[model samples]
Target: MSFNVGLSGLNAANTALNVTGNNIANSATTGFKSSRAEFGDVYANSLFLGSAKNGVGSGVTTEQISQQFNQGTITNTGASLDMAINGNGFFMTSDNGARVYTRAGAFGTDKSGNIVDANNNQLMGYGVDTDGKVVQGVLIPLKVDTSALAPKPSDSLSETMNLNSSAVAPSVTPFDAKDTNTYNYSFSTDIYDSQGNSHSLSQYFVKDNTNQWTMYATVDGVNPHDPTSTVPYTATLNFSSAGVLGTTSVGTPTVGAGFTQAANGKFTLTDWVPAAKNAAGVMAANGSAPADGGLVMNMTATTSYNTSSAVTAKDQNGYATGSLTTLSIDGEGNMFGTYSNGKSKTIGQVVLANFANVQGLTPNGNTGWRESASSGVPVVGAPQSGTMGTLNAGALEESNVDLTAELVNLIKAQSNYQANAKTISTQSTIMQTIIQMT
Candidate 1:
């Protein structure tokens, strides 16, 4: 009986050392939760021996208890592909139909643009529609549709160009068909075609007279509104002293791939003019110009006058040529891409999901987990909402392992194991002495 007790002690010590070794080995493992060995003394007893003052004590038994999931330090590593769970939750992923959960947020877009975890498991999330909005109560696996991802032109063009409001328009000289050239202002940028092919588009604003200007534009190698296909596209921009759209404008003929412009000389100065007014007020039809009267012109056309057929928007056939710029993502996951044409459009938004019992999830390795019967259905939601953590773009969350704490625990477990080993040795010595005496 004494030898059996000593043997049990030895077994317990061995198990404790093994547990410590496991902790040390996984100290650097990402999303790894250190575990402690649970021990309980066994009592040898029976109803028939209940009257005994003390029953024989059996050695310790080893059990791996639940792991501690306290929050880990969230170090921000500037990686857009990195994600971190700040609170009580794990990222849900699915391998084929096998669901798993994890705290590792290192994610990236696969060749198909589907968000995949390190193990190639698809990150589960609600799908966002074309409008970049997630429908309620519908939880589907999320995947980025790379094939369908394409840049689209903007539907409308908005511009605020500032010119010397007091500048005089040039007189109509046959040699200078566009008298507005006196002002001599030109700006150019690249605009995309229907196929997203870029083309250089330029606009020159020339002062024609006191309040009129002729705008000339060139697209690709051809002029969109040339009179004989030999001249550049030209339009008149007229403005009253008060910067109001004047009645003098030209009706352009349909030309170009997806745009039309008025014939070079046919566009009148007043047709596309906008109301001209200084900061003060509009100028009167009478010769009385407001003290701050200036040349301000704004014009919009029902038809695209500059864009190529290749530059159509997603839901529309054509967009204004002036609708191109850069792209950006906001905290709300809204993706905005700008075009060289000075236009920006919402491209798409990111999606996130949540689970009711993240702790109840079963680990499936590779920093991932699977949904078990213990874990309730996942509750889907966007990031930074309710219990969900805010998303930090271009940043990744580092591993949550506390090296110091793990080391300390390792020391404690080792000491405990050593003490148990000593007890076993002492017990063995005593049993040997008893046997020798017998």
Candidate 2:
């Protein structure tokens, strides 16, 4: 009977030692929980002798109980793809067709642009509109379009100019009718044509007289090749002596003066038509001095102006069509993409997944775990919202194993096993002495 009790103690101690060894072996394993052995002493008694206090003891039975889960320390890796749950949530993932949950965040994008976890489970998110507003009930797979994105140019532009009323025309002139020696004004800017082709645009100005000027534009060159009209555009600007803009005879209010178009599609400057003296009957041999020879002066335009002209031009509004450049992620998980055209755009935001219960997760190998019946449904959202951790780009998370604690537990289990062996040996020695004396 003493040997039986001693053997039971040895068996129970061995079971506990084995359980501790298993814990030590898997201390470094991801998502591993340690278990402990439970022991119960057995009692033997007859139905009639059950009331007696001197009942015989039978031995012990050992069983494995619940595994204890220790919260692992989280180490930041700083990767936008990498994620970590600080509290009670787990990340939900899928294995091919099966669903899984885990606390691990090692994530990446596939060739198809799908955001996947370690086991290739796609990360989900809410879809966003053009303005980045959430579209409810929309489950977007975390894939972004890597194609080229460009800036949208504004639709309108404006320009203003001022002229010096006394500058004289130079003696050397380039045009027989006009002086190349005149202030040849040229201002260039970029503008996209109707077809989205960008061109270097220039507006040329030449002083025709004191209060008048001529304007012409060379698009892409001194004169752009016009496929439809077969001619470059030319116009004139005219001002009254008081510097007030005149109106066209066709009832078009002229805020400023310019050449008028003829029925033949030709442009000509406005010249004084000596008021047809009383219907051509009262005209003198020479027309009376032309009404106040239009004020003479050189044109000097600056960056300031106030005009109501409906057609305004810009200095620089277009860019050269370019290819895609580098990409980056921001604090809000927004992906900003750059292009060779000196333009930038917001591509999309990264998605994060969270579960209701992390401890109830099922292990899926590769340091990943999956959702089980005990784990509630996954709650998907962007980082930094609703208990989710913010994204840190270009970093990874370190394992949460504690080596010092595991080593200490290993030593204690060894000592306990030895003590239990000694009890078995002492019981055997007593039995051997009793046998020798008999």
Candidate 3:
């Protein structure tokens, strides 16, 4: 009986020593939690015992190994994909078909463009819709869309120009693009078509008389609405005596295309043939114009000032297809993909899950945990919502193990083992003396 008791004590000491050694070994591991060995006294009563006071303790037995899920220190890595949780939640991931949870945020893109851990297990999160909004449905492996972004057709153009009010009328009778004497001032702007091809559109202003001027607009030396027609679209601008723009009228008869005049000389260019390089490398008209002309020339900001003609401001809406440039994550774990075309889209968000009892979680290796019966069902939510924690981008969480504490526990376990060994030795010596006396 004494031998059995001493053996149990030795086993308990060995278990405590193993636990402390494991903690010390993983002290530098990321997102590693420390464990402690619990013990209980073993006692038994004889069937013929007359009183309970006669019963004696047997030995110590290992009760349970409890894990501490405490927060660790967060360190920056300057990598956009590296993330760390700041509160009481774990980053959900998927392996084979089962869901797992982890605090290690070291993640990167895989060959299939999925955000994955070092083991290539995909990180789980809410997927995105066509418009880049979260679906709010079942959690799945988060994928980074790596396809090139399509180009958007030019829908509108805007510019503000000034005409010289003090300049005299041109000496030439008819307006000409090459002859400088035919017009008083000119301006040029680049516009895009459905295919993202660029075409230069120029405009000339001729002072016909006081508070009156004739304007001619051309696209790549041809009329925008009709590429075959060499005649440019013409309009007459009528201004108030105080230099404010007033009424406007088209000079040429409506021949299937021209400027659609609006209030305050704001004309919308109607019809446009998308310009492209032909077989001979020369720009030719392609039948790909915007159905709505897609060009808005704003002369509302035009003024008859006594200065040189100048284009003060200009803006257009069009771009070519672009590739992904970089990515970023916010505190809410929203991952945004920035493209080369100066556009950005939300890819996905890192979803987190918390449990009612973190200690009840079962370790599944790879610094991850699986839900167990002791732990209640996971509460799913986005970061910063309810008890869930926010994320820190470009960073990671260090292990929570304390080397100093583990070392101290190691010494205590060694002492317990020695005491148990001494008990066994003393028991053996007494047994030998009893045999010799008998």
Q: In order, what lDDT does every prediction score?
A: 0.53, 0.53, 0.84
lDDT of 1 by residue, 1-438 (tens): 465665676676667667566666766665666555677887777677655457777666765444556665666666555666656556667788776767676777688767787788877655555665555455455554423334443222334444444555444433232444443566555443334445445556665666666666554434533323534455666665665434444325354322333332222111111123355774212222111211112243212122221222212222334432344445544445565545455544444556666556676666566667776776655566667666555554454556687677767766766766677788788888999999
Over the stretch 1-438, how does candidate 2's per-residue lDDT look in tens digits?
467776787777677767667667766654455665777878876676646568767778784344454456556555556655544444545566565555556778788867787567876555567865555455556665566544433232234454343444445554222234544455566654323445455555556677655555444443332212223335556566765433212112222232244422123223212222255575322232211222111222221123322223333344445566766665455666677878766656655566666555565566666666776667776667777666555443344445576567667767766876787788788889999999
* Residue-level error in angstroms, candidate 1, position 127: 3.4
TM-score of each predicted structure versus truth? 0.65, 0.56, 0.81
How does residue 227 of candidate 1 score in lDDT? 26
> How many clashing residue pairs appear in each of the predictions shown?
39, 22, 0
| Model 2: lDDT of residue 153 | 34
Q: Could you give me the TM-score of model 2 versus the true structure?
A: 0.56
**Model 3 C-alpha lDDT versus the unseen true structure:** 0.84
Which 10 successive residues of model 2 have the least lDDT summed? 289-298
Error of 1 at 437 (Å): 6.0
Scanning candidate 3 in windows of ten residues, the lowest lDDT window is 251-260
TM-score-superior candidate, 2 or 3: 3
Per-residue alpha-carbon lDDT of model 3 for 137-159, expressed as tens digits? 57889888889977666667777
